[model samples]
Target: MSLGKGNFQFFGGSKTLYELKQNMATIGQQLQKTEGELSQKAIDPTASMEDIQAAQKSRDDLKMRFDLIKEQHDQMEAEQKAKFAAKDNIQNIADPNEQVMKAKAELIKATIRQQPIPADVKQILGDRNNTGGEKLLPTTMSDQLLMEPLVKNPLRDISTFTNLMNLEVPKIAFQLDDDDFIADTETAKEMEVTGDVVKFGRNKFKVFAPVSETVLRGTNVNLVQSVERALESGLAAKEKKVAFTKSPKSDEEHMSFYQTGSTAIKVVEGANIYEAIVNALADLHEDYRENARIVMNYADYTKVVSFLNNGNSTYFAAPPETVWGKTVKFIDAATDPIVGDFSYSHFNYDLDVLFERDKNVRTGIEDFVLTAYVDHQIKLKSAFRIAKVIDTP
Candidate 1:
């Protein structure tokens, strides 16, 4: 099957896409070995027709299996394409309000599936039709807003190091040093006892959204969408800020991997993109090279893709999911490619979310105010293995 940047395929669901490629390589090698054995049989003067036929059959069987694997890979690619097209259709809808509402509904569905729905929320949503008259106490027509499940957030789903924590206390302490290690033997040397202790305190992030009273009580599904948009905007910005913010000079905020002097950094020279990527990988410490990842913006990644598509290089094979045999992630914030041991970096959360709503006696505006609060911390365990390439002409 023809493979390109857009139509890349992978199989073996639980295994990473790269691992499946390794399987294909193994199959190809076995086919080659079997074919070689058959060639030797053909050259033997005492070889019988039965021996040659059996060897040929074995090689043919391996080829068939390889073909089947390729077919499965192609099928997966087609399915992925269809999914992307469908998602695009939803996103490009003509009506802006309808588009946002649909997206918000999806998010609501996802959240409801995972957590218990509050009685008040259920009452507000279930009473959409307003079946009861003014005399009916609980079945008032004023609460007609419909609700949907939550949409799944891709960042939270795909993040390797992000985690959730449930803590009654606001702060957690981490020991930077282990319980002391073994030293020189024989003539006892003085034991080294000095180390640093860092405290990870919860930082609160708050955001507010104001909605008119008419929109809040309206039966229109768009109302939920408006609220969702405001909340999502805040949350998305917070996530990006936490992940990509440059490390600070002091302990004012959490240090990110991109900050200068925060970790190992390298400068890339020359015009060849492929070689520059290899050099970035090389800059990683030998200990973390095996697990290192290359992160770059979509534009830079597209450049690499263009190079591979040309098929001019003889140095190494380029696979769809990897470069230099390591996983590659396309991130918009990654202006320059970063080669890092991601396992050493982690995201910690003290609370998932704290949402509050106020209706009466608020600001002068005739709108309800909704506020959301989140607490989290980011910690980089080690910086020795991480490095970013500073591209220069």
Candidate 2:
């Protein structure tokens, strides 16, 4: 009738061990009582051989029963060894009390191992790639604790994200004071609103494996210099494993990795400004070769012509015959296009500067963003499709 763990012989034999010990104590007490009763009796001169035989037989039976119990306990231990091993291999089942204590120790170790993530709380796995279209997965205890460091603190835990496009507005609206007030005049103020939606980071994008470092300092190394040499020679094992956001419920999931290597600036080349900007961006690219843009801003090329041809431009020469020279011209009162590039600066990130200095012109793009930076004195400002992408074999 026994089923599951209750039928185990070890637990059943444990009870037998207790009962046997109790029985042994009872036997000792009975022996003492019998000895007292025997001491009070007088010795019989003619003792029968049959009584002695009966006493000897009773002693042999008791010895045999005690031996049987000992054998049963020993066999109990042997029979359960295989079962315990099977449970350990198949499932991680072990002593429940010890397992719980070990789990607690693991929790403590995990907590201790995650103290190095204070600096990264501002950034989560999905910030780089905006994909809030994934399903949420259940996380283990370790996964949860590890996630705390991986997720940022500023925005609390986000479950779903939706990205909305920024809305553009047409023409500016202003308020003006009128001296004449009609008897029943109506004043109207129109509100022009541009849309910028706030989307969830986690819900929007899937995070890949996070960046981590694995140390391999062998105990055999005694000297720091030896370890240094090992590190330099690439003798020790090393790797950069990338991490990303969780996947969403639906298809067409976008996964992005958290990277901080370098940043890039956007270049908007117009008809007149195309050739000059191509050369400018080319120089930046020739210096850098490869880089990623955080964001790109595209302005109107017609604006460049407006700034140069408009009456505000200061002039050193006339409309059509100026060669490639650094001179000034005045048309309209608006500032020269050169000022716009300097002010807006197409490349404007400190991180771009840090990783892209000297050999790479990583930043300073924002200064070039607005066409006002160009003095507009150059003869030709831009050309269309002048900067073509040539494929090389």
Q: Give each prediction's root-mean-square deviation over alpha carbons.
A: 32.1, 22.6
lDDT for model 2 comes to 0.26
Top candidate when judged by TM-score against the true structure: 1
Pairs of colliding residues, candidate 1:
106-150, 106-151, 107-149, 107-150, 107-151, 108-149, 108-150, 109-149, 109-150, 110-150
Q: Which stretches of candidate 2 lie over 4 Å from their true place?
A: 1-48, 89-284, 287-289, 293-393
Model 2 Cα lDDT, one tens digit per residue, 1-393: 233344444333456545655655554565555544343332544546665555555455444444554565567556667667666331253554444333322322222243222211112211122242321121222122222333322111211111212212211122236534211111111111211121112222111121111211222122222322322222101101111112323321221111111211222333454244344344332212122011111232344345565675443244321322222222121111221111111111011000000111353111101000000010111100122123344
Which ranges of candidate 1 are over 4 A from the true structure? 1-199, 210-214, 219-222, 247-253, 262-273, 285-287, 311-320, 357-378, 381-393
* lDDT tens digits by residue: candidate 1, 288-322: 56666666677776677777667765323556355
TM-score of each: 0.44, 0.21
Number of clashes in every candidate structure? 10, 65
Q: What 10-residue stretch in candidate 2 is worst by lDDT?
A: 367-376
